[model samples]
Target: MTVTHVHSIDTAPDPVRWPDIARVPSGVTARFGAPIAARLFRRAASRLDVRVALPDGTNLGSGDPRAPLMRVHRPAAFARRVAADGLIGFGEAYMAGDWDAPDPAAVLTPFAASAATLVPRALQVLRPLVLPGQPAAERNSAANTRSNISRHYDLSNELFALFLDDTMTYSSALFGEVPARWDALEAAQHRKIDRLLDEAGVGAGTRLLEIGTGWGELAVRAAQRGAHVRSVTLSSEQQELARRRVAAAGFADRVRIDLLDYRGVRGEYDAVVSVEMIEAVGFEYWPTYFETIDRVLVPGGRVALQAITMPDARMRATRGTYTWIHKYIFPGGLLPSTEALEQAAAHTALRTEGRLGFGSDYADTLRLWRERFTANADAVAGLGFDATFRRMWEFYLAYSEAGFRSGYLDVQQITLTKGGAS
Candidate 1:
């Protein structure tokens, strides 16, 4: 794909100055914090397996010849960014071309692996002075949820199509092997969806409620299983494409796509299925999310949920903090731990029946996505997204891939049953 015209980068300016997205600490705070952050980063890097190369011909970390190499282009800027916003600034620095790596994911994995202990316990207490809380405007309230969803999902349907597999599934795919091939991605996605459908017991004449309609692939699959489906999403772009895809697949009669919030969904169903949707619901609303599902799910019905989960300690620690992801990728999102999900369900009639985690598969999936995205950079640029936007997207994908690669993040297909079914 080629571009006839490029949109102004000014339209999507760098988010470094976005106070709601990332807070630049006061001069006094930065004066003290920058040196502290630089020292801590150097100390942390010295122990990691990777190598960090500075412009002054100095290298940190173990200097393992086989380890990934992180090259810092503008050290002072990088230090100040990290001091100002922590991880969020780290990402912004990447977007601003302050640092780079031959393989960004490879360089990020070790850091993600040591996420819990990167800063000393004493220094971690200073996090509140640097990091900002989740912006109230980005919260998952009934009204704000739509805007939050629009920010990412509604960017452009065509933009997503450029990178995703033919199945158009955005969530993780369940690959059959460790190193999955690109040609098998569509099949892997189908397999993942099939597992969810099977766990939900969706079959002939069954009524299904899907909380997130991602380009309608899942809905079509459910309809193919002889289930009547109602799918809801906050993205108009996704809804439009999903509706067209459903009609094209001849499942339009069996599926109904609605531009509605999950909280506003008003029907009882045999099965309730949501894939990676719970993350968009803020931590404070998790109970409400499960309660809504409980209210709509009939007794004896199954709820198959695909969720991206982090460790409980990590979730609790970061739930209220704004990060790079919140700034440039997904806003108002928080990954729940397995324990947290179960606790949320405890407040409702839903009980966990089973759970299967495929974090490695997600890592593989994201690697493929990142590769494809880079390969299609021109196409992405042709879609009018500027260079900074491209860098942000690349960093977001690499950052996420590294999380899964290091086991800092995980994806789980969890089965829940109404009325405490065993």
Candidate 2:
């Protein structure tokens, strides 16, 4: 496999790669779908507890007077957007300044809670006809995986550093207690890593294989436990930063950060641990993901996987449908349900040992990140991101937060052992 080190982009990203984000809807969908969308949205909003404030001074929903409010600035444009793209359009409308909300996440929570039933049954049947499918070029093939990963992770190292904690852990942090405090984030991150390591049984002289290296924090922690770590990732930007962090932590000798796809990984390890990286594997490649781990692990070796999950029924409902997230943020990502994950593992020798779910902790983690990102808006702009990009990012973060906050999504740490052995 060819290895090329990726560097931070100096200027704004290429526009051709993001055609939909900055687009203005017109033509048939915009003209015809607007009025239809307006009626549908009003009907849907009335059922949710959140308040929707329209330009005509009409409010939908029977919630308290102070309920989380979604203020639609340009009702026609907002309706047209929803008509054209569904939830993706709603997000685009926010980026286009057609809507405003003091707390977007709060306003989005009730809608997320009613996700399965938000759209009328008649309209839900038209989803396959209306929504786009995953782009063929962005599929999780070995070659395409690099491009998919680069589209997001390789955007800029400094960009992520603005909102992420000092550890640079990108996945969810496991908060220690209820109502997680922002100041407790770094400690909670360490606790999350420690728990994964413990589950994988990493120790002195243990050989560890990490499928995703998010800036080397996990590798450094593993090396600190006297384990030899081989961590792989497809993102060049991540690999470069992770290597520097490992060396700075004085574990350069114990840790190896490689810019390699997981499918091509070759090694025999005592334990394999992957943090929330499986989402990018794509639903079709799930079996391959686990089988690779099984093939590379020694007998009785353990695996710890942290993933964002949805309900099994919901997973089946939305598997092939593309959304705002796939178009703008995570190109090839698809969250798995607990049942789907187990079924994938069953394809290999790995058997589920135990699992822990703390989705609310993820909601807290995202809240902090969003707050920090909003606070660092100037810094983000200085880094050369445009307002549309910022809004897209804000919506992405808040959208994800709402997913967990509403119990529509979950994050789980699952442990698996080879040969069904304890």
Candidate 3:
């Protein structure tokens, strides 16, 4: 097998290969692996609200009143993948054009609903047989965190602008009240940010610290409320744009956007806010991540965190697997469970004050992003991205949407306080 390190690119689409490890399964894993899992997969689909059309022109789970349809063009390769790696293979099938779905998220929702029980309970001990361990190169250490972040966050501002809302907030949005319009994404993002700031008690004379400044929108908004803000990020591309945006907002005097790691910060602040940033800290460093927040926060200081969480059981099961998402999108990132977050905070002075779950909002947010991305495909491809790159992004967005839609994942806005009573 050929081993080439392909990055989440900004300059150009990665070199396309027959079996690109960066995006799809490779060699034996792509072909001669497992057919047994394919048989089980067919059985599993029979229980869900989805239709799978095999290459033989027959269908599985037909007559489902409310399921999505998937057409397979290559059954042999698809079966091998599903047998070898389970869900990862299914994603690769989409990336490889082995399968097509009118509604990709819909096709995935049922599987996500049954993910925890995909394999028999007695066979759970053999998880490692199909799931691979975390890659050594992608381990989230202080030294490698910057590179891991750069892999995704540095992948061109032009590329992101093609899909993200005007605020450039890549995290989940809070569309307060249902029956919301699709175009309300930016407003929802602001609402989400404001809620976090309010929870952190950021206001006139407040000192605010923000980790993971994506183009500085949060810092600018906080500074607008007369707060002095310090925002840090390891992404050079992100920090550059954030600095410019902060200056453009006329908050350069009050808001400082720096290219620094959270572990390197020097001063204590009255409030700390990080929106979906902890997901990138890796499970191993979660304790240190929380400790840094605690140490830099003054006594009675408040923290507002917007995080993506999975059920604790799911988190534990997949924590060791280096997934396709890690290989192609986030590199070293890992979503945390609320239970894991609380456990990590056990050694810190921070305690959860209140928490709100809004997984549906994230589903809506992802749907909008995916639609926008699909609509702007021409502009995206015009940026030198190829067909393969485009498909990968589409799958990433749709996959996330399905995760939220299936209730397999959730987003939370949590308020924490220093030396809190809990």
Winning model by lDDT: 2
> Ten residues in a row with the worst lDDT in model 1?
1-10
Cα displacement (Å) at residue 369, model 3: 0.1
Residue 255 in model 3: shift from native, Å?
1.0
Tens-digit lDDT track for model 3 on 1-422? 01111122233224454254234444575455556666777788788888988878798985865568877777776777776676677777667776777778888788888988877888778778757777888888878989999989998999999989889989899996955456788899899999999999999989999998988889999999999999999999999998889898898899888889899998979999998999999999999999999889999999999999999988987898878798778988889998999999999889899999999999888888888788888798799877667778888988899899999999999999998433
Give the better candidate number (1 or 2) by TM-score: 2
Residue 227, model 2, lDDT: 100
Q: Which stretches of candidate 3 lie over 4 Å from their true place?
A: 1-18, 21-33, 420-422
Q: What is the lDDT for 349 in model 1?
A: 82
Give me the runs in candidate 1 sitting further than 4 Å from their true place. 1-26, 420-422
lDDT of 2 by residue, 1-422 (tens): 01111112234334574455446678697789889988888888888877988878888886698777787878877887888888888887877778867788888888899999888788888999987877898889987999999999999999999999999999889885644776789999999999999999999999999999999999999999999999999999999999999999999999998889999999799999999999999999999999999999998999999999999998999988888889889998899999998898787889999999999999888988888888898799899887778877888888899999999999999999997445
lDDT of 1 by residue, 228-263 (tens): 999999999999999999999999899999999999
Worst 10 residues of 2 by lDDT: 1-10
Error of 3 at 201 (Å): 0.4
lDDT of 2: 0.87
